[model samples]
Target: MKWVTYDAGSGPRTGILDGPTVRGLGAGVTLLSLLGDDGERLAEAGAAARTAPTEVRPLDEVRLLAPIPRPPSIRDGLCFLDHLRGCYRAMGRGGELHPAWSQTPAFYFGNPAAVVGPYDDVPIAPGCELFDFELEIGAVIGRGGRDLHPDTAEEHIVGYTFYNDWTARDHQLRDMAQGIGMGKAKDSAITLGPALVTADELEPYRSDGRLHLEVSATVNGREVSRGTLAAMDWTFGELLAYLSRGTDLLPGDVIGSGTVPGGCLLEHVDTPDMAGFSGWLRPGDVVSLQGPALGHTRQTVRPAPPMIPLRTGC
Candidate 1:
């Protein structure tokens, strides 16, 4: 079942997607709360939503928010090394993978407060010139655990959703140049929604323990990049294991599989004969992403809001 948080004239409510229709769940039954008790409650809620006949509405009639709009936290992992290779090539740098990459799944914490609905407008980070979008798949944590084993981490994942890791390339490179971090660059916005497809529903595509879904991105209805989920160097289970090594995992915590190969504009910029690419995004550009299992959503780019002046020469 595809679980979602939507508003149909009665405030945000939990709903289950059944084709082009949405069935509202019991009041106060949120997707995050269903992650408790090792998914026992989620199972009950799914069953109840299926049988309840009231509150049924067309999918397009409701406003969709991120399944877990504001998860407790988010950890985005660089599981696709090819994406790094492409970036390095564009930057005139070496394309060799760091040896440590094989030993660990590197990840960075994201701003949960910046999370936005899948279809909401995306504002250009103030002062940002080169904006990009990362096409990724996000796994939602269901059961909390510490130092979980990769083989057993599967028990903790409740569902999957499309993740659009919007980026301000100029801001990121500037921060990384200082050898410090990439927070302010990425904290602008991260899109999640359509619906969180329950893990069981996607089992058929699981191969060698990794989900293999074809993912693609489009700008103003033109396809920009495409790749498969199976291309990741590590599985979601492995990522969970690595992230949980030092702390406890919590329900509603999101795990993002970083940009797929050729999944963002930065990787394509400066390529041979790069026409139709404006080098960066402009206001009114619509960006969208999706996979076969995941529903599609689009957001138009909006000019950044007024910037806060910094204290200078104090």
Candidate 2:
């Protein structure tokens, strides 16, 4: 069944997606509360929510937070070959370091506090010249384990959700060249939600033609980058297995499956013919992603809160 983390009257809540309707779980219905336990608890919660006859809310009324809003931690995997290729081409770079694109997934930690609701505003950092957005799929871990075999990786997954790995290419390129990544790729750079669809419900999407995924990002109602899910080089299963090796996997952890090819501004480098294509995003730009089954969410770019200025005394 499809699961969602939503806002009830008081705070965040967890529920099952019954068509466009949402059926909330028992008291204390946050997804983290459910997935933080063994798989048995999750199943029990699902059953309870299914038969409880809860009030069904329109998908838009209640805000949709990241599946695991404050997941113990997040490790986004760089396993999509098409995205890697385009990234390199845009930068005039060369072959990938990982030949098979199967090496340990290159991942990074995202800010837990900045986790956004389905239709939240995304800050566009001032002075960032090349702002870009990516459409990705994030997998939520259900069980904790270490050195998990490839075949058993899926068992640990609880569900899937849409991700907008919003990026600032200018900062990223500068930091990467220095062998470090910090302000360039942290906190608030990621956007996720709408709801999490349990793993069992997403199995059908794994088939060749069934995935038929398409991602489109529009700026102020004009289309920019667009791509299909069929182009991903590595499947989610492979990335999970590779990451689990020799490392402890925990519940409520998120694994972001990088961006899709041509899914951002970096790919349209110095092209005049690409009208309405501007690399840098200014405040007031509205970005949105739409997929087949996953509903669409929009983020309006706004100025970030002012930072405290540093003072010095001689």
Candidate 3:
């Protein structure tokens, strides 16, 4: 079932998206609250919601929010080999996979508080000129577990949503040059949602132990990049198992499937045509990331607030 957290005339509330109408799941029932239990219960609730007589509203009448506005934690895994290779090449490093990449999934923790809804405006970071967006899919945790075996990892996932890991590429490259981590470079706003498609609803897209979904990104209504989820070098189950090792995976935690191959401008900016562009993203640009199973997230780029002066001498 497709689940959405939206705000109508009142406030944010959970609902099931049936066709073009939203069937309210009652007040105070946020997506995070529904995720706090097994997917079976959530599915049951959705079944009831579909058949129950309730106040229904046009989908366009309500504003959609990130399925889990405040997820417990956000971890993004670098599971696509091609994306990594392209990123390294973009940074002037050779496009070769590191030996460690084949051994395990590499990931970074993202700021949960920086998350914005699908239709929200993303402020370009102050002093950032090379802004970019990573097109990815996010798996939301349904049940908590520790040291979960790879074979059992799929059981922990509840649903999926489209994710945009917005980045300030200039800051990211500078930090890498100085051997600093991605803390500040990636702490900016990340976007998720439109709606979360539960795992059961995605059965048709599963094949060869991987999801067969096309992922794409469009800027200003023009397609910029495209790739398929089947190209991921590491499966979500493997990433989840690796993440659960010695750590408890909590409900509402989000695990991203990294950027897909050719999913971001960073990998293509060096091309002759793309290099002519002055800024990576400008005010009024609309970026939309879409997947067949997971709904699309559309964000409008907005100018950043004026920089706050930093204190100099002590």
TM-score of every candidate: 0.96, 0.87, 0.95
* Model with the higher TM-score, candidate 2 or 3: 3
lDDT of 2: 0.72
Tens digits of lDDT, candidate 2, 204-298:
66665234556677777777667665665665666778777788888888888788766677766755636755556777888888766666778
lDDT of 3 by residue, 22-132 (tens): 988788777787766667668777877788825688999999999899999999999998998988888798898769999999998999999899999999987788888
Q: Rate the local accuracy (lDDT) of all candidates.
A: 0.88, 0.72, 0.86
lDDT of 3 at 211: 83
Candidate 1: regions farther than 4 A off: 312-314
For TM-score, candidate 1 versus 2, the one ahead is: 1
**TM-score, cand. 1 vs. native:** 0.96
User: How much is 84 displaced in model 2, in angstroms?
Assistant: 2.2
All candidates: CA RMSD (Å): 1.6, 3.1, 1.9
> In terms of TM-score, how similar is model 3 to the real structure?
0.95
Model 1: number of backbone collisions:
0
The 10-residue segment of model 2 with minimum total lDDT is 305-314
